[model samples]
Target chain A: MTFANAGTLGALPGRRDELVAHLTRPSTALAEVGCLLYEVGVSEEHPDTVFVVELWTSAEAHRASLELPEVQESIAAARPLLSGEFGGFRFDVVGSPLRGGA
Target chain B: MTFANAGTLGALPGRRDELVAHLTRPSTALAEVGCLLYEVGVSEEHPDTVFVVELWTSAEAHRASLELPEVQESIAAARPLLSGEFGGFRFDVVGSPLRGGA
Candidate 1:
């Protein structure tokens, strides 16, 4: 079953753009490790928040990715830019009309 | 450019499953309107919440979806099951490593 982690991360003050830059950095490593999709987004209505929607092969894969050196380094790099305010939910994808062969 | 809307909808207590059922119903109409993905998810940690991550060809496409009779009907069916609490954000997708032809 596909696992999903979708949420908002609040950037510290005006550091949203920097945080976005850090997150949007290409990571071949992620796809190599069971990430089907890792989407990052931002809304003008909530200037300090960065939205993320990830589709992983499984919950375990998502957890394992966090331990990767590249991912760890990425998290460390973005930690300072975050406000520690996070909101969202993780779920096991029930289904999609798209067939999701993608 | 892809437009993304990722968020959580609060379902009335014990009605989450029904809400999910309503959302996961097959909708060929959505794809015709430029919906790339409309994923529905649920978490044990947040049993009352349904997580959704939508990818549209553009923000306009997403807005247009809401006006569809099928979509409006879906919303109406799900509304009574909801608690009226919504959390999430919308943004124009910057890019994805997947090449996103998917």
Candidate 2:
């Protein structure tokens, strides 16, 4: 089963854009087989609130990605800029038009 | 600008699948032009957690959908099954393989 994870990040005041840039770094690590999509987004209602949504091939694959050095380093780099609140939730992709038919 | 929305819903004990069914009703309202993808997913770690990831032509279109009778009714119907923790965030889709060239 493919895995879709979404999370809420509270960026330190005025550092939201910088945090986005940090996540936007070209992830050479994404070349790993399971990473389908990993994109960052800013909330329309709250600028300091950001979303990290990922589409991976499976649960195990996603778990593996977390162990990769790139994922570990990214977390370290993002810690200080974070307002200290980071929450993420995962979802199983049950339907999608991107597959040509929902 | 296209809008992508993702949300987390906590299901009342043992009511997760029920809530999913309510959300899965063939949404005729989805035929609306701006409504692209409206998918429901369950988390691998927590069965009680659900995700609603939506794609709309614009934020305004999504706002409009909320006013539709169908959308309003769904909200009402699903309320009882929800654990009362309804939170969603919107994201700007910067890249996607779905568009053929990320």
Cα lDDT tens digits for candidate 2, A11-79: 999998778777777766764658876666676578787677778888888889889887799889888
lDDT for each residue of candidate 2 in B67-90, tens digit (9 for 90 to 100): 998889888998999998878677
Docking class of 2: acceptable
Instruction: Choose the strongest candidate by DockQ.
Output: 1
- Per-residue lDDT over A1-102 for candidate 1, one digit per residue giving the tens place of the 0 to 100 score: 799888889999999988877888878889988999888877878899888889999999999999999999989989999999998778899877566412
TM-score of chain B of each: 0.94, 0.87
Looking at model 1, give its docking quality level: acceptable
Off by over 4 Å in 1: A100-102, B97-102
Model 1 residue A95 distance off true place after TM-score fit, in angstroms: 1.1
Reference-based lDDT, residue A84, model 1: 98
List candidate 2 segments past 4 Å from native. Answer: A96-102, B28-31, B44-47, B91-102
The lDDT for every candidate, in the order shown, is 0.85, 0.75
Clashing pairs in 2: none
